[model samples]
Target chain A: MRARLILWGIAALLLIALPPLATALGQPYYVDLARRILILAIAAISLNLILGYGGLVSFGHAAYLGIGAYAVGILGFYGIANGWIHLLVAIGASALVAAAIGAVSIRASGIYFIMITLAFTQMLYYLGISLDVYGGDDGMRLKSRSQFAGLVDLRDPVAFYYVALGVMLLFVFLTYRIVNSRFGMALRAAKSNEARSRAIGFPPYPYRLAAFIIAGAMCGVAGALYANHTGYITPGLMAWHQSGEMMFMVILGGMASTAGPVLGTFALLLVEEVLKGWTEHWQVILGPLLVLSVVFFRRGLAGIFFKPDA
Target chain B: MALLFEQLLNGLQYGVMLFLMAAGLTLVFGIMNLVNLAHGSLYMVGAYLAVTATQWTGNYLLGVALGLAGTLVVGMAVEVIALRTLYERDHLDQVLATFGLILFFNELIAIVWGRAPLYSSLPPWLQGHIKLFAGSTYPVYRAAVIVVGLLVAALLWYVVTRTRLGMLIRAGASNRTMVGALGVNIKLLYTVVFGCGAALAGLAGLMAGPIYAVQPGMGELILIQVFVVIVIGGIGSIRGALVGAIIVGVVDTLGRAFLKPLLGTMIPPTAAEAAGPALASMLIYLLMAVVLAVKPAGLFANR
Candidate 1:
């Protein structure tokens, strides 16, 4: 636990300091990239809630991201500049969608669950493509960054980076609290052995569903942040590849551990950037790394670096 | 009415293609207990190889033969080099490793063939139309595809039910450890099964090359749908794959063809126009969802 604290401490210091460090180094482009990482970290953290704690491998988490993004995009096209509405619709729609998906598909275990989630995400992807009014197959550019009634300006890079950081940190704290709560323990127990937990009078469905929805809502927030960061929305955002990347982050960071997703987000995006600078086909390196990580680092980067006194 | 019949045939052809893809996926899952996401990559390879081979040999039949053989070799190589290590791992590890294989294969294809979709036309013999009924007809190639698919299906059924290889496959699916204890070469059997699955996927790909756009990511797009088929039909059953594939294909095609017109009569034009296409595409997924709700083991789950 001491190691976890120090790890969190270092992460906080870096996220807090990075924008200025980036600016001082005359690499404002990196500040933008950092913003992207923070946003993605938030999403991965949400994924960790269900996948890590509850053992529900949702291959369609990107659908929530897409739903959240398209919520913003659809609203933006209608000139709804209220930030609160964007956030609410993102969370609300994502939770509703998650609830529906969870209610129907959460009964499945293992590969069935994985495939069902994939089907849901692909459905949304096609829906996005079908929306000709929202720019259809080609994505649309936001006319303006989300407006917050002068409380904050997203058009400014540093401010946007801070907002993204603040959102991530808030969720990280929330996640820590929830995972340690009675509900989280029960959910974890259920994941480890569902029938045993049920025999012990702890129903698995509601808790798992709750975790699923909460995670979906959290990812929805990240999706909104993502739209504001990139100033656009596209169907590609919900593709399974994005979900796989997020899974890699959560896996790379370490499951059931707070701050793992943050570390993973940094590692994956950083490697991609550095490798892209070296070669156009960076996936050649990345593909092997993913396989190797699974083979060697079962507990992820967190397992390798910190044993956490277990 | 005539249009309906044609659309029904279209659905059958597409379903047959899907069955070819899903059959391999189901077999590997049932017998080997391995979830190979790279199955789609094999499909893509078949398409690419067939396109290239056709150009090289100037004979479509020979090109298809070569493509199927190439896919079998590639599949076996993948199983030996990558998947052999993964059989004992958890589904998560298997998923991640095979996902990496997908990335590697896609990039490899991009490097070799470029990112653009390849265009492969059907041979002249399979072009034109076939009369199915009075004043109703279908594409000759599609009719040929149906015939070929049925033949393959019949061949598969024969091999699985009437041969020693079929008996071994069934026994392995039922009890892998027992089969191994019975002195079967489990390793060789796995490799052969994986290769056969790849050949099926490849055959589907080569047959589809002339119809669908052959591209780097094309395999994955169809893969998810194939997953839906297996889920609806049951993961480990070939019979389930055939049934589920037909249902999905027919539902998807009929819905796309008629839903717009049907909805237009009930709703405003703008709403119908906007929602018609989305709803149409969602038909197969909806079917899968309903089927799963009713039977969690799927329609014909043997495992």
Candidate 2:
């Protein structure tokens, strides 16, 4: 456990030092890439809350990402670029939607759960494409980055990078706490054995639903950061494959482990970048890589650090 | 009134297409308990193969036949090479593995066929319109698609109900371990079932080529709706897939066609115009959610 903490600490320090190191190396493009990866790590970590720990395999988590992004884009469209408002609206809307979706989705389990979540996200994707006023299928560009009342200038790349890094760290810490809490224990119990959990007097429904909503809301914050990171929002962001990619990150980094998804995000994206650099048909290679990883790396990258369970 | 009638027919045609895709998916899900996201990729493969074959032979019908056979072989191969191991794994593994297949197939198609979308032209015999009633006409090709889809569904029904293989499939779905103990070649059965599912998806794909864009990721566009159909109709039941597919197809089509006009009458035209498309697109999802809320196992859950 101490070794794990030390490894995580070193990882965190490296993340903190990324911007300066990348800039000094004259590969400043990597800072921007690192920011995107950090934002996505937040998304992946949130997914880990439900998928890794709670055992709710939601295939539509990208809906929250899309919603969060659209919140910023639409708000910016109407000239409301206040960062606080963007964050609030993103979280609130995603939470409400998640609550509604979770309420219905939790009634089902296994494959049904995965499909229903995917269906809802598809519904949202269709809605996004139909919003003609908001650029519809083609998507819209954010007019400007969310304003922070002059507290932090987002226009500065370094400032924005630190902001993203800070938020990601905060979420990593937050997820760690949640997963170790009493509520987390209840959720995990229900995940392992719903009937047994119920017999033990903790019904899985409410806990599962709560975790589902919390995961969605947390992902919403990532979406807000993602929109600023890219300066664009589209229905494509909520595409099923985007959700699939996020799930892969969670699984690849190591499910149920707080730091695992962050690691997975970094690993998957970095590999993708390298492959893209090598050839245009990168997904052809990446696709098989994902398959092989899933088949062979049953425990994922983080599993290397831990002893096998009996 | 005639326009509404024609639109309803269009919905039926669309529903028939969805049924073709949904039937195979439901069968695989029921019998194998495998969630094949890459099923869409098979549909895509069928379309790509058929289009290329048609160009080679100058015979659309022959091209489709070759495409169908090719997809069946590919499907069986996939089952053997990739999906065979996944049968015992968790659904998460199945999902991610198939997702990997999707990426591979889409990119592979792009590499082979170029990223530009291809157009599949209807043969001379399949063109023109059929008069339904006074002042109403529907395209003959669409009418044929409906007929073909229904025939396949009927054939599927007959096979599932009357045939020995159908009995085994039903037996397997209900009790896989028991079937294996009973000396059935379970592995071969899974491969055949997967292949049949692939052929169905391929049929849907090849037929859809002319109507929709024959592009790399075209399968995904319809795949999600097929999931909705499967969900609404209960996962394992063929009847449920047909019913769910038709309902979704009709609701989606009618909503898109008339929602703006319907909403315009009750509200400002501009407001209706803005909200109509969005609401129409979301109509089926709302339906699915309602169904889920009321019957989480779906309307016709097999077990």
Candidate 3:
């Protein structure tokens, strides 16, 4: 428990310190990248809730990112610029979509769930493409960054970076708490053995559905942050390939670990950045890298670095 | 009326094309219990090979034949080399590994064919329009696609129901250990089944080349619809794939084609125009959701 508290303290300190360090070093680009990394980490952590803890390998989790992004983008296009309002709309929209979809999707286990989630996300993608009002295939651009009512300036890189960091840290802390709670125990039990969980007087359905909704809402937060960061939103956000990438992040990070998603996001982003700089056909390299990771290093980066305590 | 007939033909053609894709997907899942997300990559390979073969041989028919052969060989090779190792693993592992293959194939295609979309022209004989009824003319190639798809479907049905291989396949799906205990080489059977699935996807890709743009990301686009078809039809059931594919194809194509006009008759024109395509595109997903609600295992789930 002391060690856990120290780890959280260090994490909180790092989150508070990093952006300022980047700005002090005159490396604003790293700050921006750091901010982007935090947003993805938020999404990945949420995914870990369902995938790592609940053992529901949804291939379409990126749909929540798209839902969150579109919520912000569509609302902003109609002249709502408050960051809190956008965030609320984004999370609410994602939770609603997740609930509606999860009601049917959570019925099927394993591969069917993955495929159904993927198919539903694609439906969202096609809808985005067909929406003539939202720039259609070209995508919509934010006229300005989201506003925060005199508390912070999101348009300022440093301020936005800090805001992202603060939010991410809060989410991480909350996730840590949730995973150790009664709900988390039930979720983990369901993952290990659904039949056993049922035999023990716990109905797996409601817990799993609630987990899905929470994960979706968390991803929605990431999506809203992403739209504000990039100042653009497109149908590409909801594509099946994007979902694949999110799953890749969860697995790469070591699904069940607390810090796994953040670490995985950093590793993947770094690899992508470095490889793209080195070669035009980096995916050829990346494909094998990902395959080998699953084949040889199934425990992921976190598993390699930090052995979980029994 | 003519327009409606034309749209119906278009829907049928699209449905047939989707069956070619979905059948392979369902079969592999049914037989091997493998998700095979990279199946679409095989389709892309088929289209690329067809384009290359046509250029090399200077004959469309020769190109088509070579494309099919090449895809079959590659499919078998992939199964023997990569997928064989994956059969014993869990579905998540399978999804990840196949997804890796998708990344590799897309990049490899881009390297070989360039990032630009390749334009594949139909042969002159297949290019012209044919009159079907009263004065309505349809593209001969599309009509040919429908015929070929139906023929393949019939051939598949016969092979699955009337042949020794079909018996083995059914047995493998239901009881793999029992089939193996009977002295049948389960590994070899899996390889063959995967190869067959790959070939089907390849055929779909080759046929889709002239209809849709052959490009790096094309596989990803069609893959979603194929998944929807398989899900609604029941995973691992070819008959379900056919039914699901046709239902999705007709709904998607017709929805895009006449949804606005149909809605305009009932609602205001502006709202109809705005909502038609959006709702149309969502029809299949909505259908799938409804199906799942009623029958969570799917409509024709092969036991």
Give me the candidate number with maximum lDDT.
Answer: 2
Real contacts retained, model 1? 0.62
Listed for every candidate in order, the interface RMSD values in angstroms are 1.0, 0.7, 0.9
lDDT of 1 by residue, A1-310 (tens): 7867787788789779988898899989989889999999999999999988888998889989888888888899999978899999999999999999998889888999998998988888888888889888888888777788878999999998999988999999999889889998899999889889999999999999999999999999999889988889999999889988888888888887786788888899998999899888888788888888888778877777776311
Residues A247-270, candidate 3, lDDT per residue (tens digit)?
888889898888788888888888
Off by over 4 Å in 2: A307-310
Badly placed stretches (over 4 Å) of model 3 are A1-15, A308-310
lDDT of each: 0.90, 0.93, 0.89
The TM-score between candidate 2 and the true structure equals 0.98
- Write model 3 residue lDDT over B1-303, tens digit each, in one string: 999888888888888888999998888888888889899999999999999999899999999999988999999999987888788899999999999999999999999899999999778999999998898899999999999999999999999999999999989988899999999999999888888888888899999999999999788778888898888888889899999899888888988888888999999999998899899889889988998889887889976
Error of 2 at A308 (Å): 7.4
Per-residue accuracy of model 2 over A122-232 as CA lDDT, tens digit each: 999999999988999999999999999868978788899999988998998998888888999999898888889999999999999999999999999999989998999
Error of 1 at B287 (Å): 1.2
* Model 2 lDDT at residue B287: 96
Ranking by TM-score: 2, 1, 3
Name the better of 1 and 3 by DockQ. Answer: 3
Candidate 1, residue A54: how far the Cα is off, in Å = 0.6
Residue B163 alpha-carbon offset, candidate 2, angstroms: 1.1
**Native A-B interface contacts kept, per candidate:** 0.62, 0.83, 0.86
lDDT, candidate 1, B187-286, per-residue tens:
9999999999999999999888888899998899889999999999998999999999998888888999999999999999889999999899888888
